[model samples]
Target: MGALLVVILALVVGGCVCVVWADRGGPRWTRVVAAATVGSGRVLRRYQKSQRREVGGGADGDGD
Candidate 1:
């Protein structure tokens, strides 16, 4: 389980690096990887925000 987790993390990090490289004018294949990476990041961000809302009752209540 631990090894699997490490591999998954490595892949995610690698994808993110490729995305950055593509943004800097990397090869065509990198551009494809970059698009997928960005899309996945957006999805993950949305999911995380929803999870936080559920756990926090949709408000921080700190008056700000």
Candidate 2:
């Protein structure tokens, strides 16, 4: 389990590095990875925002 976690962390960190490299003009593969990383980041952000809205997402305490 720990090894799996480490691998996942490594992949995420590598993907982030690829994103930076792609932005600055890197290999073609890096561009693909970077696009995937960015798309996933956007999806994650949207999911988090929706989750927040489902849980205490109102200032006036009037949420349904």
Candidate 3:
């Protein structure tokens, strides 16, 4: 499990690098990878924001 997490982390970092490289007009494959990386990041951000709303959306009035 630990090894799997490490590998995933490495891939995310590499994808980020590819995003930067592709911004300056890199090769076709790097451009493809960068687009994928950006799309994945958007999905991940949406998931995280939804989780936060679920946790903190309580309507109870406690403060005075």
TM-score versus the correct structure, for each prediction: 0.79, 0.81, 0.80
Q: Which candidate is the best by lDDT?
A: 1
* Tens-place lDDT digits, model 3, residues 5-50: 9999999999999999999999999999999999999999878777
Candidate 3's C-alpha lDDT?
Answer: 0.88
Clashes of each: 0, 0, 0
**Model 2 score (lDDT):** 0.88
Task: Candidate 1: list runs displaced more than 4 Å.
Answer: 61-64
- Cα RMSD of all models vs. native, in order, equals 2.5, 3.8, 5.2
Quote the positional error of residue 28 for candidate 1 in Å: 1.3
lDDT of predicted model 1: 0.89
Ranking by lDDT: 1, 3, 2
Instruction: Compute the lDDT of residue 6 as modeled in candidate 1.
Output: 100
User: Candidate 2 on 1-64: residue-level lDDT in tens?
Assistant: 9999999999899999999999999999999999999999999987877787778554535453
Lowest summed lDDT window (length 10), candidate 3: 55-64
- Number of the candidate with higher TM-score, 1 or 3: 3
Using lDDT as the yardstick, the better of models 1 and 2 is 1
